[model samples]
Target: MPSKSSARLAALTVAAACSAATTLVLVSPAHAAAVRIHDVQGTTRTSPYAGQKVTDVAGIVTGVRTYGSSKGFWIQDPNPDDDPATSEGVFVFTSSTPKVGLGDSVTVSGTVSEFVPGGTTSGNQSVTEITKPTVTVLSSGNAVPAATVIDARSVPAAYAPAGDPAANNSVNGLPLQPSTYALDHYESLEGMNVQVADTRVVTATDPYTELWVTVKPRENASRRGGTVYGSYDAQNTGRLQIQSLGRTADFPVANVGDVLEGTTAGPLDYNQFGGYTLVANQLGTLRSAGLERESTEKQKNGELAVATYNVENLDPSDATFEAHASAIVNNLKSPDIVSLEEIQDNNGATDDGTVAADVTVNKLIDAIVAAGGPRYDWRSIDPADDTDGGEPGGNIRQVFLFNPERVSFTDRAGGDATTAVGVQRLRGKAALTVSPGRIDPADTAWKSSRKPLVGEFVFRGRTVIVIANHFNSKGGDQGLTSHYQPPVRSSETQRHQQATLVNAFVKDVLDTQKNADVIALGDINDFEFSGTAQILEGDGELWSAIKSLPRSERYTYDYQGNQQVLDQILVSPSIRRGCDFEYDSVHINSEFHDQISDHDPQVLRFHP
Candidate 1:
């Protein structure tokens, strides 16, 4: 089925592989002389002899991927060529159980091909491979190539290739310079043995049998465990993913700031999920950086504890309610008031028109009570039809759950799901015209988004206006593994608008009462140091409560190897100046694979 162009190219490729570099050998008219493994895999991402046949390519087998669609083995020359612009190793795609062993010295003939993971439409990097290989066992138990040190100096300062839509494949047709860009550096070492040493763990081990570490420290490093993710900077360059797919044991769970004191020897791999990975056979010592899952302490007398949690779209029919309730009771220490986001409708993803989450909230409250927690009363406004964005027909919205045993919801007249709550000054205090009312629901910023829900809660003879929010997610933003150098964040524009509206509401409250105990808390869906969070903390009207903790310990979420903050509780200036606040980013989730929710609930205890 090979076409004329492909067949001719394959014939020439076979001839090149047939020729030996420094040995007398039989030369076939149909075959080019066997070439070095480096000749086929030039410095460029795409091979020089792609679509052509290559034969007699001799090397020692370095790795084997005998499972999944990528069933193949990697081979590398024991002694590399002098030119650094060429790779001495290449993957031979068998597409089935490979006959080669780990240390077999073999000669192979196959068609050189470039395989784009996720297809060409994804715009990810393509893997150069030898397909449909014919192998000749030359020897067995041969020595493998030494692993190249992957220290700070080995990695370039730059993070990604310069181009649009992520990976800039081929660098706009320019020749690759492996020493300049980090992408080029990984490309040059593709399929070769590599080692990383004296690294810090950024992401914990996930169910996929992988973890992330930074071989070199990056800019804006947090004090203890977190990594401050700022604008499109090259901060993630030193980070590398480590997939222990070939390991005989399960990968250990690690928190951020953990140290790996020893060397991890593995072959460099580039795949679809992450960019460059070290497929280590044995991971080094994981030094505990004194970071672990923390249970927040209970509130003190006169201090009302308020918490916010994104339940990851909790529904009445979902099976995670019990676990979530248990976490709230045992880990979060039963806050007096809790802001719950992503509360779906009763049917949950059925696409029906039923938008009411009364059944859903009741079940969660009942579960909490059954799990040895407080008797809770919840409040929220249902979205119009399917206007809210989430799982289709799920109508995920925000809800406020207050412990009636300690606090009460002050509901006023004239409020509905479609009506916006009016802010009024009542007796030298800010009061919502209607309790559990929607905030500017008709605004375009909240179009197809979960509108902010404002509730007035009376605790210990004092009232506080709590605004719960579930802003637009960071789904559309390009990932850190993106190929584009310093990836672009396209979701900030809308989130900025959302933050502005929320900040305006807080300012209105402050105008009514300079010391108004207004706490805007929920899933902000951005980091504490992000522009969105900064905008919400405008002119000292409201301060992010997470900032009360030491920078080294301020994190509620973990992603891509970095302990981060996404859920925050922003309070008024009076609350921060009073300095009687205890904020805890409950570490019950995010780092564990068996988590009921992807996020950890945050509790802020203060005198209101």
Candidate 2:
């Protein structure tokens, strides 16, 4: 979708034509038939003619991308092929800036190659390309091919077809079924010019100059305009990423539920970040729908309000402390207990073996008091230098911020990063041996992850057990748009192990006291319906309170247009049986352009 320099076009054409003639003379007559763009693309993810040279393939230049590291021009055959499984368009990758301009009728002679965007290890589908090409420009100013219209009707409801079992459950070798599967439909039109009209934005525009829009306006629609990822089966196939081919200053800043007015057309591209993207040559007008953040209600006199917020590697150096203070004071109404995740050391990200976070934690607490909130005190144990896996050298860990006026923290001696906490029976009740202590820190499940912090608190003559956790993140997992059908979630293996250890710890406390009040809350880093959540909620030991909301509202994070839950607060059987609790997924961030954090904080209010 970008244009190239026309000054060197004539010279490159002369040189390419000579190279083509010499290359063709060495080939025999058996494989000299004229090849089309569809033949180079073939019916599968990889081209059938990969590594083979084809001569005199004619097509009109639809788009010329002259920018970025991968500079290339897109060409589509004006002539039609009857097969829908094959794409008629392919990219001609020039090592540097392309010499050809838009609408140039050219015959390309090049070796067909399948280029994987993030290498083969990324498990991404390969993009068919013509590399080291020789070009012959027949004419200029030709009419470009008609852009294919992609709408709700064109995209299939099913996300993808099951992969073949014989090929390690990969869909790479399977013939594309454009009419049956949505991924296949996009694969069939990989490099072709496609258009969408009047689509609704499902994700806010980020600093990366990209946003997501949904063609099917009603697919898993949430009240706040994001597409809810309720289950693994439905991935909301209509969500597509859009990036402008023009100047970045000309790109529109949009939020969820906003409307992209009129038609926007571009060449369909596959990349490492988002699977399929539309590099728009003609962008649509952005119309704001006026989406706003949400606030939760204040807790009653006897009810205790608890919340969990991932401040996204917060340190004293960040400018978002005041904004986060306002969120706790105004949006959350100053909860009694706040489990804060990703609290970094004093000098953030400068790994010099400093692990204490008093400077960072006190700054946030001071900001909260300045925002007309409570005078809060914090409790946390600094992990061994670089033991917790987060922004390296920052030594990120979980900390509990409690209002002394509302609740009291019961602190005992001898709690550290390496020592394991134990449950004790004292005065016919379950209590933590060390108030703020790690749970199974020596376990292999928590090798480089944050250990769950166990603490005891008292409110209205009742003692309560609280566990703050920041589990292993989903870093190395394959995305939903992977070449392997039903992509492998390798990151979940560690999260599952972490969940099992936490579940055992909770079970230990419950076994000591049957009616103890337990609240396990923080960024779990997995979906509610995922295997990690199931292990955490083992045998009625805990219940995810986020599921208390409707199916549309059970999300705390937004990634690539899918609003899913990576943070959760699971209560014990005593809290679940009473049904005297309220849960809220406060939408202060994750849906806005100017966000302090990428996750929305969750709140739970109940009486002990």
Candidate 3:
């Protein structure tokens, strides 16, 4: 036998010769070669004979894994043209710049090599290494160039789920795919800029920095056994970051009928407080394409109109206001008075240096103008000035915006005004007094926690006491217990307390104004079936404006794999008569929550 050194030298010589031959084959002037991701074959594509200098390979990213402190990601290309049952011929190792996700179609090019694969305890196929593969994403639309945007819902069952986890409970009826890849992948994208599109519903818009958007893959796609599905929660949902561009002095900076576009770079991640969700990073507007305009004809009759939606956090920023102003004005059924939650204020002052309280109020006023509606002159009880606790910038509360053209500003009431039952422990409390003269109390049920902003609005011929509530969250089980409470230990004993307080207030208001119509709306923070909601409905006197419709039409928030009825528009029997309230839980926030705000708005349209 030859000496050890001599043997090694011989092996090297053989490898060098093989490499040279491979180079010649690739450099030949006469032969032009290309390989589709689906066509590559063999059990192991190793260097020398295995390391072919393929120019390009096209296929969808079936799987992806990241390792080595953001060094790069490993992508799997399981092409249909390849061995279907086994991922044998698919590319095992591909280098990326850390912005790739599963189901994305891409074309990669570079010299392929073989090395030992990592992260496996069992001894398996050890081939790895793809040198300098230039990746070109093939997603559709100009949002991300070269990236192939897949519907994800269009992916096969083996790769994507057909319906949400809660709905179908499997990958097209099969067991749910392990979320190991999603969890890890989300961690990698945290704070990084990314974009996603899907048809889910939005839930919450608190803690303004990170907006949570939930998406639910359609169910029909799964029943057909051709598509895959995913659910929304802290994990798998997509996310977008909220950011502001400069202000414009135009009448309608961006109308409700304009498509919003923008880009930013930062880590993107997912968290599951109660649902799987996507959080965006470095979000900003790219452009606004005008959408189809709705007929602006106002209803001839005087009716009590109500609507609800997750505005994705209408912050006190000019760019955000402009981008969404038109949609809020036009897409909405043009209700006489609009009940809004998640109206944010700047820190201590408005962007223009006005008092933060005044700044927040004015930003909304300006947004109404941009949306092509009459000026929204309104008021809130608290000035959003409390800085000791609660959400930063005391201005992060629910507010009512009314079109002065339809309703006049009469008297303001509610918010910190009453020391009623369970109201002492609450910190930021107050209610706005509006025209038509109605009294609303800060929903004292969540006094120990984040109190609900409640107020009464007097319409043309009726008194509508509207309670805007932000109740105990379903993020954790804390709200489920009878003694559950927040830090202050106020009246938030259980999730139901928030609803209970609202129920009591509504009952009291109805008792006082027996013939008056009461409309309650806002982010209740709990689902429809929960005990908290039962209190508000009390003996069927209060009706869920959306429940009168089909099951598929009742959801206002998407959680985990199930769509839960969180945000709602509850109306007393008095208002339900002449007011055929049309309520729509718009899915806009579901698509862009991570970038905008988490909670969707609830709009009520009815004859006053």
Cα lDDT for residue 371, model 2? 99
Q: How do these models rank on lDDT, best leading?
A: 2, 1, 3
Tens digit of per-residue lDDT, candidate 1, span 1-608? 24434543342222112222222222332233296688888867778889999878878888877665566777898878787767788888776667777787777787898876544544456677888777766666777777888887877877656663333432523456677777777778888878898788777676566778887676446665446454445345677888764643656666667877798877787765566788875578878787656688988878899999999878877899899998889888888999999999988877779989899999999999999999798888888888978877789999899889889999887667788887898887889988879888888899878899999999888888899999888865655654444555677888899999999988988888887889998988888878999899998888888877876567777777666788999998888898888888887777554567778889999888
User: Candidates' lDDT values, in order?
Assistant: 0.77, 0.88, 0.42
* Of 1 and 2, the candidate ranking higher by TM-score: 2
Error of 1 at 179 (Å): 5.3
Candidate 2 lDDT over 411-527, as tens digits, reads: 999999999999999998999999899998989999889999988999998998999999999877888899888998998999999999999989998999998899999999999
Worst 10 residues of 1 by lDDT: 15-24
Better model by lDDT: candidate 1 vs candidate 2: 2
Error of 3 at 27 (Å): 28
Over the stretch 1-608, how does candidate 3's per-residue lDDT look in tens digits? 34434543342222111211111112222222276433333321222335677765554443333422212333334323323222222333333233555455555666665432221111111233344556666652222212122124322222223333462222112222223222222222221223445322222222222232222243322121111112222223232222221122211123211222333322222121221122222233423332222223344456555554445434555366654565567656456666666555554323332224457567756776867766776655443244212344434455667766676544533235333322111122222333222122344443434445554455674445666666565432321101111112222255666566667766665655555566778777655654666787997558777676555555554433334567888888776775565666654443232334444555666654
Kindly provide the TM-score of model 3 when superposed on the true structure, using C-alpha atoms: 0.50
Worst 10 residues of 2 by lDDT: 14-23
Clashes (backbone N, CA, C under 3 Å), per candidate, total 14, 1, 89
Error of 1 at 183 (Å): 4.3
Candidate 1 has a TM-score of 0.83
Model 1, CA-based lDDT: 0.77
